[model samples]
Target: MAMQGLLPFLAMVIVQLGYTGMNTTSKLAMDYSNMKPLVLVAYRQIFATFVMIPFAYFLERKTRPKITMSVLFQIFLCSVTGITGNQVLFFVGLQKSSLTIATALTNILPAVTFLLAVISRQESVGIKRITGQAKVIGTLLCVGGAMFLTFYNGPIINIGESKIHWKYASNSGDHSSHHQSNSVLGSLIVIASTISWAVWYIIQAKVSDQFPAPYTSTLLMCFMGSIQCAVIGVCVNHHKSDWSLNSPIRLVASLYAGIVCTALAVFLTSWTIQRKGALYVSIFSPLLLILVAIVGWAILHEKIYVGTIVGSVLIVMGLYAVLWGKDKETKMKTEGISVVMPLEMVEGSKDLELQLPKDSGSNKELIANVEENGTIKSNEDEEKNLGLS
Candidate 1:
């Protein structure tokens, strides 16, 4: 039982680790091997489609629902937001910003997701309640942290150079106007990617409600994304050389991102979301920040600034605060339902008893009973209106 309980958590950890590897390897490919971001994203989708489709076919063949045009369109939208926009922006951002910075920025996902959910009425927030207040404050803190990290480098805290420094890392201190402009643009692009990702979550929630086949949905999204990205890549860069996979690093980055990050990570996350919820999976995002920071420091010799550290701390704290609030709210609702259920059952029993000839004694008593039942119904209605049902 304990092992079963731990399995999901372990799976999530592995998923984050896979993403961490993707970030590092992708940075290596782009920074050192000069791989174009769009081309890399195009390759990722193509390769991910290849890796996912077979598994989706074999595993979900019997259980998969017939794909309707509506479902297909939803999948296409998901591909646009989640894969094409998200991956392209993220890769471009990663190429411009350091891995640690990109990873840290991803911690804003839960906050962004919460805001989107509330806006869509998929989630409710009661500003009058402590839980809602916490969530609001946490979201603000998370956004503030992201802004701090992006805008303020502060004084760099030297944490002793890596034993084996990457070639690109040795000259990472270049502060040319072009580099600075690229960095700022990349940060904004990455922030936009988070919005796209949040939109994907909302779309995915709707898609899952209709479709419910995680593997098949993932495969279809990858297939659609591959085609779209390929078109975008071709249009953006007509040079055949930009799409070359001759370099080992380029091949490795593409394959790793496709197989590990997209295929495996998506499957694992979907499974975890089924077992737990989206919030549970999202809470683990901060783990990637730590993993990437350490890996970047040691492997890529990325500098760790005080501002980055402070911003990371704030983001992680705010992330937990929001999660804690959400959990508490869920628990309270569950308890409310549990408490109301017994009263409902008792009232139901009373009504059944009142139907007997002997108990049907007084019209006055019946009117009182009707009023009490109306009160209960009104309470239930209020709960539903509050989105706590």
Candidate 2:
């Protein structure tokens, strides 16, 4: 029972871990191997489609619902927004910006998703209510923290450096104006990706409501995404040489992003959303920032700043606030149902009592006979002794 309750949380954590791995390895591949982001995105879609097709076919064949045009269209939109737009922009952004920046920016997801959900009326917003207030405050805090991290790089906190220095650590001395410009551009791109992702979440919730087959939906989405990305990739880069995956890092990054991040993560996220809703899935995104930070510091020799620490604390606090609000709302709803049920049962019992005949002709005659024979039988006694009465 405990494990069943924990499955969604565990699934979200696994999804974040997959994302963390993608962030780290993809950054490495782009930085060192000079791999193009579009190529990576294309490969990821293709590989994810390949991995998901067999599972969707065999596992869900018996249970899958017939695909309608509406479902198909939603799946296409999901492929465009979630996979194609979100991933391509993210990889390009990660390549141009630092990993810390990319990770911090991702903390904005919950806020974006919340706002979109509310606008779509999928999520309720009552400013007078505490739950709504908490969500509002949480959203503000997340956005503030993200902006803080992006714009303010305060004095570096002197955490102990990693012993295992990466080879590319010494090569990152390009702090030129051009590099700064690229970083800002990348940040903007990533922010755009977040908006796209938020829209996708809303659409996906609708899709899941209509068609609850997570693996099948994911397979279809990936298949569509692969075709779309392939076309985009061809248009962006005409040279066949740019599409080469000869580098080991590029190959590993593509495989990991595709298999773990896209195929597995998408399925888990969809299943979790169907179980717990989209906001629940979005709230777990802040975990990626922490994981990416630790991994970046340890493996990539990335420096941690005071601003990063401060901003991360705010983001975590905000995340907790949002989750607390959601939990409290759910608790209140459950309590309401529990309180109402017993009262309803009591009212129903009373109605049954009122509708019951006072006494049948035969029962009244028997009671009268008993009373006439000098048996002390009151009305209450008669009713108690004779169920009909």
Candidate 3:
């Protein structure tokens, strides 16, 4: 039981680590090898599609539902927004921005998704409830933090020098107006990517309901994204040299992003979501910010600023506030179900007792034995375990 509970936590941690590596390596590929974001995105899509094919084919073969035109269309939309739109904008933004900023900006995804859900009428704010208040406050805090992080640098935090230095580390001393403008633009674009990702989550939730086959749906999304990205990549990057993966770092980056970040991460995320709800999965996102901050400093030798620290704290606090509210709501609903189930059972037992022959020795003994054995009390015990009294 303990292991079962721990597995989801472990899986999510691995997923975050995988994404951190993708960020670091993808940034390295673009900066050092001059790989165009579009081309890299296209390659990553292709690799992910191939990697997911076998899993979708073998694992979901029996359970996979027939793909309707509606489902196919939704998957295409998911491909466009989730993969192509999100990845392209993010990579381009990362090219112009620091790795830490790139990861930090993504913490707003849950807030974005929540806003979208409320707008779409898929979720309710329930402002009268404390849970709803938390959600609202959390969303506001996330937006405020994102804005602050984008606009303010607020002096660098002197955390001493990093012992480990990356060979591909670019000079971080450039504080020119041009560089600052680019960083602002990049941050805005990255925020746009988060919005796109949030849209994907909303659409993907509907897709999951209709399809119910995660691996197969992911495979189809990747396949569609690959084709869409390839056409865009080809048109944008016309030079034959731009398409080449001669550089080992570029090749590794693309492959890692595709296989680990897309394919494996999706698998692990799906598994973790199955075990512990989407809230639980999303709660791990802030950990990515922490990991990226460490990696950006220790490996890439990126400097941390006061704005980064303050903004990150606000974002993380808001994220937890939102998650805690959602979790509390879920527990309330579960407790309601548990409470009603036992009451209904007790009522049904009473009905059974009234219907039975009063003189029937066997039936009387059976009921007495059950009461003595405390079978119905087990339900109460469960409620106790769930903290519902």
Model 2 stretches with alpha carbons more than 4 Å out? 1-16, 168-181, 262-285, 334-389
Write model 3 residue lDDT over 300-386, tens digit each, in one string. 777899998888888878877777766565455222111111111100000110000011111221111122123342322322221
- Highest TM-score against the true fold, candidate: 3
TM-score: the better of candidates 1 and 3: 3
C-alpha lDDT of candidate 2 relative to the true structure: 0.64
Looking at model 2, report the run of 10 residues with the lowest lDDT sum: 340-349
Per-residue lDDT of model 2, residues 95-182, tens digit only: 7777877777765666677788778765666577787798789888877887776667689878897787656433432321234557
Model 1, range 65-160, lDDT digits (tens) per residue? 889999999988988988888778887887788778777776676688788878887666667778778878988989998888888878889778
Of candidate 1, the 10-residue stretch with the lowest lDDT total is 346-355
Highest lDDT model number:
3
Task: State, as a TM-score between 0 and 1, how close model 2 is to the true structure.
Answer: 0.76
Q: Which residues of candidate 3, in runs, are more than 4 Å off?
A: 1-8, 170-180, 274-277, 334-389
RMSD of model 2 against the true structure:
17.3
Residue pairs whose backbone atoms clash in candidate 3: none
| Residue 269, candidate 2: C-alpha displacement in angstroms | 7.1
The TM-scores of all predictions, comma-separated, are 0.80, 0.76, 0.81
Off by over 4 Å in 1: 1-10, 166-181, 266-280, 334-389
TM-score, candidate number 1: 0.80
